[model samples]
Target: MSTRRTLLAGSTAALGLAAGAAHAAPSVTAPQPAAAPGGRPPNLVVVLADDLGYGELGAYGQKLIATPRLDGFPAEGLQFTDAYSTAAVCAPSRGSLLTGLHAGHATVRANPSSGARVP
Candidate 1:
């Protein structure tokens, strides 16, 4: 009688495991949105300033520079308050801009001499 009871208990546990495996829940996934029709990327423009502090612009709270022309730019364009250049000097920074790389990865690390002419 005890042997029969053990067999029945084992069979019931096996059946429960099989049922759980058979009735496993399907995975839910978020639906992907449709792509844009044109397949073209958005336009972008980058502006760099030399020897200019952030507060020197009227948009940045400068009152004495008389920056009327540049004041309206922030309203029409995207302005970044926390943006920084790759380099403190102009040459490496310009090199990074032209090459689409940071100063550490730029090929030209320093400004060329004034006597050195580009052919």
Candidate 2:
């Protein structure tokens, strides 16, 4: 198999294991936002990192990393321990996340090379 394929496979397996571990933990209820005035939607922010390990964050029990702000997120926001990415690779994962679909259902599955033409 190609290096990219191998890496994707490994990442998928690792993420699956992490998800299982998260599933074993107790669930937490997310706090709901207050209704906006004039029926306007509330602002939302999502932070995503590539190739970040679960144990690298202070909130996830990393004593070495000084993530004070991130550590405090649980107090004011909902934290999901069992969350998962739809794909092992960036392009596919992002597509699945945006579309709310799994890898099998997502339209884009892999990142094509710069010179590769995509339809």
Pairs that collide in candidate 1 are none
lDDT top scorer: 2
Residue 93 error, candidate 1, Å? 0.5
Q: Give model 2 RMSD, 1 decimal.
A: 16.3
Least accurate 10 contiguous residues by lDDT in model 1 = 26-35
Query: Per-residue alpha-carbon lDDT of model 2 for 1-119, expressed as tens digits?
Result: 45434645665676676667666655633333357896765766677776677788887888986988777877677665876777777778776655556688767888776857553
Give the best candidate by TM-score. Answer: 1
Off by over 4 Å in 1: 1-42, 112-119
- Residues 78-118, model 1: lDDT tens digits: 56688667787777877766656757776777666775843
lDDT of 1 at 31: 29
Q: Estimate each model's TM-score.
A: 0.52, 0.49
- Runs off by more than 4 Å, candidate 2: 1-43, 111-119
